[model samples]
Target: MDERIGLRERKKQRTREAISNAAISLFFDNGFDQVSITQIAAAAEVSRRTLFAYFPAKEDLVLHRIADHETESGRVLRERPGAPLATLRAHFLDGLERRDPITGLNDAPEVLALYRLIMDTPTLAASLLRYRENGKQALEEALRDKENLPQLTARLAAAQIMSVQWALSEDNYWRIAGGTSADDAYPAARAAAEQGFDQLAGGLGGFL
Candidate 1:
């Protein structure tokens, strides 16, 4: 049973990677909007039906990772045993420290190019906005256990958290776009993220 499950998981992971890589290659080669689901499946050497099983739409081929991040926020919050704000603050700060590529603070040229591709594509940009909204909603649900908060407070807090994270990500991206090396971008992004988090901490008692 264990072996079977492991194999299944590995297969899924490989397929996911294949789909993502294929979609990115195509998106960078042609354009995000120019690519179609059938073309992505062909590139990945998978049937269109199989691709849909992993990703319901063509956008998922590029946006699956974002969806994962959205889902992960809720997981992190749920697993946190301490103060919610401190928990999230530390979580994101750790992500910054690790120079996680998703943090957008890294100077990977390819990554920057990917960002530019997303920016240049209307469909990708729209998908990104939807992903952000989904992330906010996920966080709100995760934060629902907080006490002394009125209804809608969870969503309000989630909005604030998303705003800070979004700002930090954009700052990190801009730092790289300004021609800073990855190493140089790291500290600057970290410091900026820290400063932003500090403001949130002051306002929300370390939750920001």
Candidate 2:
């Protein structure tokens, strides 16, 4: 039974990757707004229904990874061993220190190209906005366990934290897009993340 589940998961992952690869190729070639899921499915050699199963909407094909980050803030808050704010602050800082791909700390040529693609495309920008909104919601959920932080308060706090991260990501993307190397971007990202986290830690006392 475990073997069967593993096989199924692998197959699902392969399909998703194929779809994403096809979408990116088409997007880079002809632009994101001009591409359709049906065309992507055709390129991927998958049926339209299969494409929908993997990605319900066209944006999901390009922004599939965005969903994972949405759940991460909540996970960090809930599973953090020490102070939540400190944990979050340090977590982001560590990602900066490590030049994590998800944090946009790196300025690899491919990363820059992808970032440029997202920026040049209106659909992608809208998708990114939705992605950030989802991240804020997830952070709010994580803050729910903290005492004295009412729902609105928790949400506002989450918004502030996620907003900072969002801004940092955009800045890093543009810096890389503007010709900065990963080596040069990492220090800037680290410093910016540290500052942002420090501010959140200072102001969000009751929540974290």
Best by TM-score: 2
lDDT tens readout by residue for model 2, 116-137:
7777888887888888787788
Candidate 1: misplaced stretches above 4 Å?
A: 146-148, 206-208
Candidate 2 ranges beyond 4 A from true positions: 146-148
RMSD of each: 2.4, 1.8
Pairs of residues clashing in candidate 2? none
Candidate 1's residue-wise lDDT over 1-208, tens digit each? 9999999999999998998899899989998878888899899999989988988877777777556676666678888777777777788878877777668867767778877887677887888998888888878877775433554777787888789998888778777778887677777777887787778777777333
Clashes of 2: 0
Clash number for candidate 1 = 1
lDDT of 1: 0.79
TM-score of each: 0.86, 0.91
